[model samples]
Target: MPQQPNCFHAFQQDVSAIKLPARFTFPFYYQPHPLAEIAAEQLQQTLLTNNNWQHNFGLNADDDPDSAVGKMFGILVVQDQQGQLGYLSAFSGKVADTNALPGFVPPVFDMLSKDSFFKDDLAIITKVSNEYKQALQQPLYSQLQRQVSEQNQAFDKALAQFKGDASERKAQRKQQRAQAKQTLSEQDYLAFEQQLSQASVIDKLKLRDLKVLWQQRIQATQQSLDSVEAEIQSLAKTRRKLSNRLQKRLFSQYRFLNNLGERKDLNDIFAETPFKVPPAGAGECAAPKLLQYAFEQALAPICMAEFWWGRSPKSEIRRHKHYYPSCYSKCQPILGHMLEGLALDENPLLINPGKDKHLAIVYEDNDMVVVNKPSGLLSVPGKNIDDSVYSRIKRQYPQATGPLIVHRLDMSTSGLMVLALTSRANKALQRQFVERSVNKNYIAEVTGIVEADEGEITLPLTLDIDDRPRQKVCFDTGKPAHTIYKVMQRTATTTRLSMYPKTGRTHQLRVHCAHPQGLNMAIVGDEHYGTKADRLRLHAEYLQIKHPITQKVLSFKVAAEF
Candidate 1:
């Protein structure tokens, strides 16, 4: 394998004391190894000082909004052929509208290069679109189109008038026949009826002639219109064919390599997934580019991590300098092949964190009961696991008739949960939830200090179609979610908050705190939106509701373990 110039970066600080990771990174999850963290910090410094290129990341006050965007940067720790330790850096997608930047790994395939076929095909498509637009502006074509519209309108008016006049004449003839029948002989009456029939025959011939005249006029105009449209249609057809061919060619060129020197294109990687076709930017993420370069140069891959930089995007919740997991939609299938045969870090999600935990019962009655749920326990049974709050309660009370659980908490969230013992109690408690009559409060510790004491967040949320179970802020096709928060305690490094959610959307509280438009801080231990920790640092603390049988307000409180 050949080496690229000036891409591999050796560590600046002394890392002799740090222990290297035993296995490579699991791209979709896992905390950053210490060596990877050091490499990331060095790259971030380069981003601040390097001036060879210009891109508006919206970090400055005067940056242009149209061009500004945040980027995901990744670092891959590797060992060169001589056993020299260093790392490779890469940015997701393109940087400064190009892929060839100093101190970064090159793209798997550069579509923007001067000699690439993509540029030539794109130019051809653009020319066809321009010609199509110009053809529509031709004077002859415009005139012919107006003539078609006017001719149709004229024919409708003439036909309507003719029918109306014929109706009037028939009514007058009927009255005259009745009068003649009363005053004249039968023979005279028959002659009068014959005269009325002749008039009707003449009107029918006139109506037929009118239709023929309009048809001829319309046909003459349409012929001219069709001649002009033929060229436009031809251009449109060519554009579609060219665009499809260009896209297919581009996907084929984006070939990725694994540790064993195996290769697969974008189309081949995504063929077995639910989305039959590879999404728009499938092979261009930071993780794939870094790993591809490492393999190409025979650099032994050790560990990797990706982080967000600059201003956050409008939809996804991204904070500056926050470590994030690889996206599931685009990179999961590709990495699944790229990481083949590498003894990677074990996926933490597959292991049950609640296997030895116990359910603590707080209060009990014939109608309802309150219990303190432990963190790392599922509120309901999941696809792979059957042990949850519902399953545990069912085992304890075999005589319980209705569904044991009324509401829910996220599997990572620990708090107080109320259960119903009877069908009537379940119905009554469920109604209160639907009507937003139940009052609840949550306590959480975030990663940063919050300046404001209290505030409200009104952001709409929807699921990322490609990434399941993860919600993003979407104004277009999302449900309304509202949350109110007050700061309870603040330290130099963290802020403890009490949050009240008005709506019960999935991940409402976590997203609200993490999103830039909301609190701009993630819950300290939230693995989904924040960095991983000992626990999620979020707990359901207080809940108040009306009793089903007693009709009296019942309030319950549980202190957080953290």
Candidate 2:
């Protein structure tokens, strides 16, 4: 086993046949280069056979709560100062309760080191947190709280009882005055009225006195409770302040060097973005770790890739041995600065994928039109590109009125789409979609063979706030997404499925198919959740809706190209 300087592992096999990538990888989105793939394979072999460390990735038993989590690992192919090719490996965040590993690159900043100021400040914060907890459990505090609660309850009961008795006495006096008016002289009636008035005044005075007495008693008890609670609150405030200060200091310590040797801390990187303060784990991803180390050693970066290494987490979809792009929230801004001087690959997202493809109108009527949308075409105009189904339809139907698109398929999805040519049709079609009266059937080829013939997926979904446009299964703050799928055909390695989405959520079918709780198979060529290929193997093959003007049922179907 040969190793280069500063945790760079030289390739054990001959890579003379492998061609180097012409440009460095665009970290936010890319397909792994050949060299990067080979490096990853070598690293994976090490993870399987080596005994240098131990950490349970929850691969064997997923139900065990004590198991450690799986992590993302990255590989960066580089040329050393002597022009020798090798790769540097790194894991996101920490591994096995530490940031250092023998074969992998070190973190840009290690806050866990014994001499680091983060450890000392964290200790103080922990101490304050303990003190706050202890204060909550104090017997005196508990006693005072109980006293306040009891005093308030007793005052309410007494006040209600006194008011009830006074009302009864007043009713009795009114009845006596009414009877005396018929049986006594005017003089006697007048004296009786005076007596009744005097009795009512006395009752009012007593009620006021009672309220004042209870208010004083409750105030004394509440003052004791407040005093005890103040200590607990002070400790809590101190702990929060200490943690924030420590976090800020730690962020400042993570100084990243670009290819040009320019340095910027995490704060400076995220200062202009929507998240002015850097997120909790901003510079802790595998890509940044790999890039930082490469620049530090003055190595020329060739290409890079990152992959997941174990069991999928509960909230997000992650597959073992699956390659993924760097996250947008944490790595995008940081890598934008780090890879500045390097000649990088062109961003695929910026190019109009549907430019050369033709949009064929399969059916057209007075009120509606159906078209066969090709793969890699957007359902509507995107932020950067104007060539889409909606845009092309506008050119075709210049006199069309109101919102034309009834519903949408993913940009990567190819097949049938219905567009309304009149305002009345648009409203009716949209209402049907909202009512779930319109039926849509999609055909997709997934990576693995599914055992079940047909079933319903009921996973709730919400946006992964950190990663834009990516949806995750979140039970806490998610909308219910339901999908019914049936196995159409099966091969040794892949399965064809007919997906009927009960609810039209953004990426509903894709997420359901890829999630562990759903089909547990990623759709073929699904770049967001699965591996990338020439195109996503998902198409809206069938659509059923009633005509708005005629009230007649209409159906449309288009065969998939693949």
* lDDT value, residue 561 of candidate 1: 89
Q: Could you tell me every candidate's TM-score relative to the true structure?
A: 0.79, 0.86
lDDT of 1 by residue, 243-329 (tens): 878888898998999999999998888898987778888888999999999988888998999999888888887778989888888
lDDT of each candidate versus the true structure: 0.89, 0.91
| Number of the predicted model whose lDDT against the real structure is largest | 2
How far does residue 499 in candidate 2 sit from its true spot (Å)?
2.5
Once all C-alphas are superposed, what RMSD does model 2 give against the true structure? 3.9
